[model samples]
Target: MAKKKSGKQPIIGICALCKKESTLEESHIVPKFVFRYLNAHSFTGRIRTVAEPNRPLQDGKKLHLLCSDCEDLFNKDETLFSNKVFHPFKKNGFDGPVIYNGDWLNRFITSVNWRVLHQDLQKITTEQDNDKPLTPEILNTLSNAENVMRSYLLKERLNLDVLENHIILFNEEIMRELFSHPHAIIQGSAFGTPVIMNKDAMYVISNLVGILVITIIKKHPEEIWLNSFVSNESGEIPQSQHFDSPIVTELRKFEDFRQAYIEGISKNQLEKLQEKIRKDPDGFKNSETYKRIMMDRKLK
Candidate 1:
């Protein structure tokens, strides 16, 4: 018998969501459109990730987690969301509360949250060093949440039983609170990640530019998440919502990280950015970034 060559095998395995054995696709956990939006509106047409502040990122995180069929399933809802809620809110100047059919909205929210949760679980399993180690009970809860979310995404379940989805609009009120750290808020507006609060809470928060999609996996009673809860039936994403939760503190920490990144930006990069603005002063003044800066200044 011929000796088998030993090398790293291709990522040909089962789809995480669908669980079908096939060649997996490089799937994006955070929708790719989010990165496009960030680049389009950014001053230099470049965006940086929270993990690598100094490195210019062309896309969001991706893994070989899904097959093409499963990927397409996600794309349908993502397109609906981007066209209706996301683009309208971010680009076309339509502010909430925007009405949406429960079907697409629920799928979209579930898809994003499921992807985040799924990826996090994989990370925890493969990597030994966890900042906040999951207790057996918490781990089991997360595993169950992931399974339910997957079933919901795959249309196997009619609803996410105990799971809750919410959209918090970045309107005048929330913007006011975040005004002091304009850079942080601006960066955050384009970011997406999971927010795990030890044994007390767990959430996957996606900032679709100005709109925040928060998937509540678990929560403590004291954590007040009001008005924004997305129902399974048709609902409206309200202009105003309240979040008195540890998630707010997590957001602040993210803002601080962004702030530190901004401060640590090399002088050469700043000069280059300034030069670019100088070359097209009129464009710079009229850009959305400049408007945000002015908004921050006025609020401060």
Candidate 2:
């Protein structure tokens, strides 16, 4: 593995990706570029994380996960994704279907899934048994998927094997159900985390504004994820998409949580947010936030 010297002192630890006892780099679970775009377009120029909604974050969540070499390996795919899909989709707000050809999209989604899964496992390791429902078999499956993804990211494995990577656009279909709580759907845009549904499915979900990346580890028999699977070589991200799984119920539950959290925001912070929007009416109107509001209004 290649190494680079930095002015800061290196912190030695077991690197999550390469499994090497070497210097680790602070890695973002979701790439920093996604958070950068969210921050740049937000009225306050800051994001409120799900963990601490009151505290504004300057970037996405990060951890001392990957070594420098592994970080470099992930960056190649991140750059491709940010350039080819993320920027253009965010800029136009999915005006039309987007087509992609090559292996980068698959690799990029897998990298994000791997990071989220690794972080989740790290958390679960320290937690008590109160967090039930994860049977030994399910846990083993999850761990195995993580290993497979890590190997795939390292180029040690050629493909995801049985695991699947899906890109579910938060297009008209899903957004329609969320019309009543437009703000929550808007807030969800910046959210990314691991989701486990019953003993049937374990997946990493990244809501990059309008785009939803779902990487599946365990899939239930009845689950039907339509037109969302990212092909190894080529695929099209169409405007119309459908998701038929218990995951949809989980999503609605999260939207309710977000709505409740939004309702609980302190009056002072709400005033500040209002003031920011007030000062930039034209900018706010043209912003993604405004567009989502309009979309919801039309749906209603």
Candidate 3:
């Protein structure tokens, strides 16, 4: 019999909303386009180097082990956003500022702040118990964060049209080639909310963008897996087609999109980015604009 090469199911945590035990896929802290600028010209198995962003980006692999349903929801949004904004921007080198989902991103980011509160609570309370038991408060903290990230994605990952206009913007004309995925949701009372993407959906996107930049700078990586899946001893079955959606599959296979981004962003773009930073100041940190997104903020 052939032996398995994969690791013990990537400890994908439970989806906070659904409370399912699963692997949390590796999600990017920043989008791929940002990094791609620093990388090579394209994903054509080539690599370039840059100095401004310091070192080369990672192998353009920003992942977060997530269950089928959560992955599906987020990827759906990714496809929509990529086609409308990212793809055009990367291909044409369209100069502009970062776009976002205003209310939803900010609201959910608050939950990440709560996670810190929960952690602090555990730290302070854990000393009191010789054998610390998982308490409701701790659970609430994590759950709160997860719900914030997962619940409002549709609100956050839209283009300016849907965002400013508050429209659904669901179209079938550009469905393009379909992708593969499975049908899965969170189960078992979750430890907390499942939030791979913070209030600013960019947390994941920026990192991927950065890595893609890195790939262009250094060299393109071999593979780019989007919310990959696996089975386990706990009745988990290995599947790829999340809900059997073609859109979902296309998202999972976007190695070139990431590579193109690296080649696309120009030095001129960086200058403008700096100007935006100066204008915004704290706004960037508060907004999804920051490439390295930190989830721990003060919960309101």
Candidate 1: Cα lDDT at 191: 58
lDDT of candidate 2 over 164-212, digit per residue (tens): 8888656555766654665447433566777787667777887777677
TM per model? 0.88, 0.88, 0.31
User: Least lDDT summed over 10 consecutive residues: which range in candidate 3?
Assistant: 181-190
Give the clashing residue pairs of candidate 1, or none. none
**Per model, how many backbone clashes are there?**
0, 0, 64
Off by over 4 Å in 3: 1-9, 16-18, 31-55, 60-65, 93-149, 154-300
Evaluate model 1: give its TM-score: 0.88
**Model 3 per-residue lDDT tens digits across residues 181-239:** 11000000001211122222211111223111100111113323322211111111122
What's the C-alpha lDDT at position 239 in model 3? 21
Better of 1 and 3 by TM-score: 1
Q: TM-score winner between 2 and 3, please give it.
A: 2
In candidate 2, the residue pairs with backbone N, CA or C atoms under 3 Å apart (3 or more residues apart, or in different chains) clash, namely none
- What lDDT score goes with residue 30 in model 3? 34
Ranking by lDDT: 1, 2, 3
In order, the Cα lDDT scores of the candidates are: 0.78, 0.78, 0.32
